[model samples]
Target: MYLVHTAHWQFLGLTLGFLAWILTMVTAGLNEWRLWHMDDVSVITSGVAWVGIWKVCFYTHVLPQMEFCRRISMSDSFLPVEIPVAQVLMALAVICGLAGSISGGVAMRMVYFTVEDRRNIRLVFILTGTLYLFSGSCSLVPLVWNMNSVLINSTIDFPPEYYLPVVPVRQQVGTAIGVGIFASILMFISGLMFLCYKYARHTLRSVAPRSTSNPLRGPWTTTAQRSNGVNKGSDNPAFLSEEVSC
Candidate 1:
């Protein structure tokens, strides 16, 4: 009999995890975390700025937008101690996701282990599941941390007469954050499914019947025999027991 019964669940978990990793990468690469708009200001003077992990983008509020705009890199800053924390963390998360996805793929459905035995297959699933959990954690920390930073720094006080209103024009969460959240959730669920599949597979293997080709070990072919005398014949001398001989 095949050792593992629940291979379908493992495949589902790996697919979901890989998809989540892709979403996270796409979210981290974009630059639309925050936006600012002016309602009662002139189009010539009104403009908007967006925040991202890598750079800040500015655009004019005119109907026909100008071709020129400004972009400031996060690595060029000198006052904030010359370290791009958000970029580094997000890159690390991507790396971890890649590693986890590869490991999980190798462990799923016995695709990578054609020459290995059944007893050691469960270990691969457990290891890959742990890696996936770590990958999810790495992805979650940066987005949430950067979100908090944006909220704290966007607290600028300005009147309505200003061209760039800070009070009414709130800093809303970007599409990247939403996508990252969804990716994190999917990764977490995938890791949990992998772990569950491992446990369930172990349980199934334990209760299954073991196969043996040797007929001597079978219960029906045992060495013991009953002494019923049904095999003895009256004509045989060995069957003539005592005084009443035939």
Candidate 2:
């Protein structure tokens, strides 16, 4: 018999995990952290800058001259002083999540393992669920670290004229941060679902009835018994069989 709840939860986990992975990849790659507006500035000379985790870009004030936008170079001294932590974490999260999804997908349904070996399926589920949880944790760490960095270091450095008139208001939180946070949460939830499914599978298997007949034993046959009867008292027999009454 098939386990309905296990399959349901596993399917849900895979779906949500894949969706979260897509969001993670998109948010990590895009450069939409900030939007800029220019007030009474000419397009030819005046420009507005936008910053993201990966790079920074400066664009002309005029909408028609957007093609003139240029990316600022990060390698001023021909080397980066620090590693790109955000990029690395997000990449690893995606990779691990993908592997977990594949394993979990295979483990949910046991079409290959014979009835005698079905117990091994639970082990696969446990392993995949653990990997998924790890992936979720990895996704969360980077996002929380980035958020903390932004909160502590976001004090206004530019002159008052550059931003809104509010004294305490510094920078606006970008869409990417929100998306990343949501994705991390979803990933965590998906991992939990997979784990729960694995537990349920184990519980079901433990309580299932065991068949008494040995799976390795072949069907009973009268020919073997007849051979044993003819060779009764011999030291060695051509065929092996259970004893038959005369």
Candidate 3:
């Protein structure tokens, strides 16, 4: 049985990629991306309102005061352009990040050694890194664009039924957007790690000359058991056992 080795780079990259993927999921579901403070308002009893990709949350003042949240409609004529774009980009980021995380997870198999070929290992690393890089890019676009919108105090032209301000004086970027930005940076670094792992693996292979005698090769295949640097055929009894008793 071959013993699999997990490189330091692969371990670290997978760990970070997993974290970023989780954060991306959370960011997609979170409703705190855009905040509006209505504390001093005479219109509604709610102190503040927050908007998310899927919903907009405010307060209702009927017989009993309650939080009222509504699903964001993409067909609404008055919605800011950033909201829809953020939704799509964030959704894409989640999907790509999940794929990259899985790839990274598979590449760092420590015990199974299922994929033993050096060429295959390098391919896995490259593919994993590229996916993560794309995930990071998808996450970053919405964050920066929405942040720019907030900086300019972007407004929604909602009808009266929506009960949302066109341009609130106290509106600002919310914590969720900041969290997404941080997650995007983490994803980018994680992608770099996997790519670096590929480069480092290549460098080590070049230094050690691993084609005929790779570190990844099982130790059971001793020097005497090899023919011209290649492992002896399975037909040879040497492959069965190094020492046998009669």
Compute each candidate's TM-score over C-alphas: 0.64, 0.60, 0.74
Candidate 2 residue 32 Cα shift, in angstroms, is: 2.5
Q: Which candidate comes out best when scored by lDDT?
A: 3
**Per-residue lDDT over 1-246 for candidate 1, one digit per residue giving the tens place of the 0 to 100 score:** 343455677788899989988987997787776555445445324445555666555444554454223343454533132115656666777787788788787776464345355565677778777777877787787777667655765543322322344443556667887788789888888888877764333333456676665766555333343358444422533556643664
> Model 1 reaches what TM-score against the true structure?
0.64
lDDT of each: 0.64, 0.59, 0.78
Per-residue C-alpha lDDT of model 2 across residues 41-151, encoded as one tens digit per residue: 453233344445565444444555553433323333321222156667777888887888788777755623334456667677677777777777776776676566545
How do the residues 32-59 of candidate 3 rate in per-residue lDDT, one tens digit apiece? Answer: 8888876554555666788777888776
User: What's the best-to-worst order under TM-score?
Assistant: 3, 1, 2
Ranking by lDDT: 3, 1, 2
* Among all candidates shown, the one with the greatest TM-score: 3
Off by over 4 Å in 1: 1-4, 38-46, 61-74, 78-83, 109-116, 152-168, 199-246
Tally clashing residue pairs in candidate 2: 0
Worst 10 residues of 2 by lDDT: 160-169
Off by over 4 Å in 2: 34-48, 61-83, 111-117, 153-169, 198-246
Better of 1 and 3 by lDDT: 3
